[model samples]
Target: MDSVNFELANDGIWTVTQLNRQVGQLLEANFSRIWVRGEISNFTQAASGHWYFSIKDEGAAVKAVMFRGRAQATGFIPKPGERFEFRVNVTLYEPRGDYQLQVESMRRAGRGDLHEAFLILKEKLAAEGLFDQGRKREIKPMPLAVGVVTSMAAAALRDVLTALARRAPHVPVIIYPAPVQGMDSAGKLVQALQDAIARNEVDTLLLVRGGGSLEDLWSFNDETLARTIASSPIPIISGVGHETDFTIADFVADLRAPTPTAAAELSCRTRQTCLNQVDAAFNALTVSQHRLLERAGLRLDRAVACLVSPQQRLQQQNERLQVLKSRLARAASAPHDRHAARLALIRAKLAHAQPRLPELRNELNRQIQHLSTSTQRLIERRGQRLKAASQTLEALSPKNILERGYAIVRNEDGEIIKNALDLSVGERLAVELGQGSLQANVLQVHALL
Candidate 1:
């Protein structure tokens, strides 16, 4: 056989393997995983545990296979002529060049629609946090009364009553009868559960029913019913259907039980079990009381052994009082004696340190004479300095300069002129001398070059 590579060859020709491979790729790429409903025919399981079957309806048929992994997980074995819904991927078998569906999962035929609806509601509620374990309430360990919500005709109610009677006859049972099946059963069940909550008589409630198909048990899966169960103040235990069956109520309830009898059993403790708990508590309390009494007696014995006679205590106190009285007498007189001695010593010191008035007067007169002499010398020296300062001021006087034969010239504005160029022709000038002042006019300007 010649193999033609589709990418390299210009002419479109290929072997059986190549054609089948290309066809399988196209089918897988164009189609997604899909669910197909049909009746099974020609079903066979291979020695290797793979399943080969044909699914057909009245009009058409398709060949399919479930590999060992998926086949073993289905739980329900496929039989000829039985209808089922298969989730599959479309593919072509390269060896036989045959088109078939690769089965991924399987379910009963009619359940596809209900199961899909069930999944949609479950996801919606789960996203809203209804199914979270943290939000779920704990079942009461000892319920005063157990409430049952089921149809009056339901056998589940009888089972619950029987179990409750056997385990906890002391606990009362409240019946809230409602249809467990049929149209609008969910509404009736919700009303019943609400009544139980309103009465508040029961500590635990059981929503129970016998096992049935998905459609038959759909009342327990209602959204409104699930919401009611979630919001219930009293803890609810859902025991609907068999151990293998599940409902939305099961997820939303405070607790889930496998059977109706199981829900009753969980509602309260058995009578014998309660008796045993009381006995254990009584025994513990008795032991605690005995231990406390023994400890108290031991403490009393120690206190008695340490007791002292009142006569001895009084004698010891009298001795302490006498010692205190002697200290008081010494303390009262010693301060006075010490003060009198100190006074006498201070008087003797005062006499020895007395000042002499005549000697003090003489010393003061000498100091006064010395001070008078110092003042006279200071005045004479200051007078000589004053005379020198007067002479210096007379030398720097302007009148003295005029007296030395120097004359001062001033412009008409009375500004003094130092240069001959400062005098303009025909400008009046003031002449200043030692004794008088006179005005003159410039006849001619003289400049020495």
Candidate 2:
């Protein structure tokens, strides 16, 4: 080796910061702004509002950063593991001497032709009113059975089963097997939906799958599948992917959930929730029955207070008739006594005039005879009036009416029934007759009007 010349001066020898700055400058000079496409991972946003993440493909990954200004202008908050294209500038962090990309702007990746197709189908279906909220069916709060349409081997199926088993073990689950991927999946899914519809065995159906790439999830974007979902009589819940992923099936289904497990939750209420509802209903029914019984008891008490035996009523009327008879007798005797007193006064006046005594005596005898005749006639008339009144009272008596081949009809509650319309068929009625009482069921009712 040749002898080396020593140049140990401060300007000649390089420090760590100087070396890093020089390398950073070199990188900035060599590379201009370029567009890059990759999946985002390890994403973090600092308090200062700078986004820090890594953009990775299958083979490699590179650190990237987007400042607050650019991130705000992008009008989107990026989720981890989403594929996007970044317009970035290659640079190095001088302090750490690390190479990285400064993202100027970003957009969804691989959204060219597939995105256009998605938009076209979405617009067609939306215009056809398939996405209208008014047209969607309501999910049953308590489904008797739940049917799942998905591949048997999918992880999403496992997730759904697990969730349903945990939440609603009492509910039966039926699986309609169909592939959720591959080229022929769309047709198979449509057929499965049709089969579920034809069977009509389940109250709600769940269509679910795990998250995947755009092409991997493309089968769910089929127009025929969307139409099939729309036509399903059973309410369908679509849980096709992660929270950010969406498909045509999601738009057409009756309800949409963010994940497979969420779809299972939406399919029906949990076992505890159903039990709570049942308990509440039972409590309400019990309270209602108690109130009804209380009302019925009060009504029965009132009816009992107003109700009287026919014998007792007849006895009361007989007592009233006796009182009226006594009053009539007293009135008839009072008039007779008054007329006798007037006759006595006339006889005293005749005694005072002795000369005309003989004629007066003859006149007095005739007058007495007339008075006797009038008194007898008045007594006869009073007796006739009393007899007529008694006869009228007897004729109008309820007991006499019942005796004349008539009955007093009453309801089960002991309410007197005056109209046939007050009774209904099969209702029990109490019929009171002259001698006995009978219980009868109404065969029919005829309105007089």
Candidate 3:
């Protein structure tokens, strides 16, 4: 036991393939799957349908490959230098022993702080019915007054004031200043909103704030503030942050605006547009009144004209009655005399014409007979010409060709062949006869001069 011999065998250097295989096996055992977030660089698509790229962060980088099949399934190719989060499986090429990631999927990360928050809040509120179309109140066309709840120091307040002044100066604004951010912001905002409602100072309340980071705008996400906004007696318009950013207040409020400025614009109607409409309506009413008055004046003038002097009217009526009496006397005496004179004249003419009456009748009858004979001849000539034209049309008809013993030969595709050169042997053709058609194949073609 004390003299036991120890022997060490010398082995030859390992080949590249063996070393690579060992490395690959170790990598497969250690990192089977992983997720990495980095900027893509040196992207290339080979003719062999393999994608090669490097995913690098500030400190380090790693090689990546997405086979054609996986890349195609992704629906879109990632561009170089674009930042993405990738889910990949770690592996080493057995032959080369290179450490690389085999990417399975990818997605964009951190679009912006506001966008991320917007997405999160939107998903959360959508489940709560705050954005339900059924629950949304319709804004009145003309409100008596509008309450503005915003940070007095905010530039957004100034923009709103300017817009309201220019658009509808008649509608007054009751401003309730609130802290838009930081620790005390939520409490101040809720108090301001409650005050505005308690005082009944406005028909509508605009809760607005300028855009800021998620942390800077954390007050808007307060549960108390959201509940307060939802229970507000007056309709609330929550306009906070940029178009991409969303908050709990946006969902709880009656209306959501992309920006504070947009909220102000939506809160009230423009003075100029309203004034123009009212002026138009007033002008139309005035014109209608003026037209009515003119019509009434014209009716009065006509009434006055019709009420002429009674004495003059009586004299005019007497003159007309006298003329009518004279006319009636003359009309009563003239008709009998005219009738007697006409009877005498007619009797004299009849006596003179009685001898020639029989001769004239005979001459008229003869002339009528000649006219009938000539008309019969002309009609017969026209009938014969018409008969010939009809026969010519019939002779040229396709039905006539079929009646005659000739038939048309058509190809399978319905094209007619007039000459032997138009057909080939073994081609399918149709022969038309008067009664039916025969399907046949062209055995041969022959030409005739």
Candidate 3: list runs displaced more than 4 Å.
1-57, 61-124, 294-449
- Among the numbered candidates, top TM-score falls to 1
lDDT of 3 by residue, 229-300 (tens): 777778888888888666778877888898877887788777567656756765675576567656756765
Give the TM-scores of the predictions, in the order they appear. Answer: 0.56, 0.54, 0.46
Cα lDDT tens digits for candidate 2, 186-219:
9999999999999999999999999987788989
TM-score of 1: 0.56
Alpha carbon deviation, residue 26, candidate 2 (Å): 17
Top lDDT hit: 2
Q: What pairs collide in candidate 2?
A: none
Clashing pairs in 3: 167-271, 168-271
Candidate 2 overall lDDT versus native = 0.83
Cα error, residue 184 of model 1, in Å, equals 1.4
Worst 10 residues of 1 by lDDT: 1-10
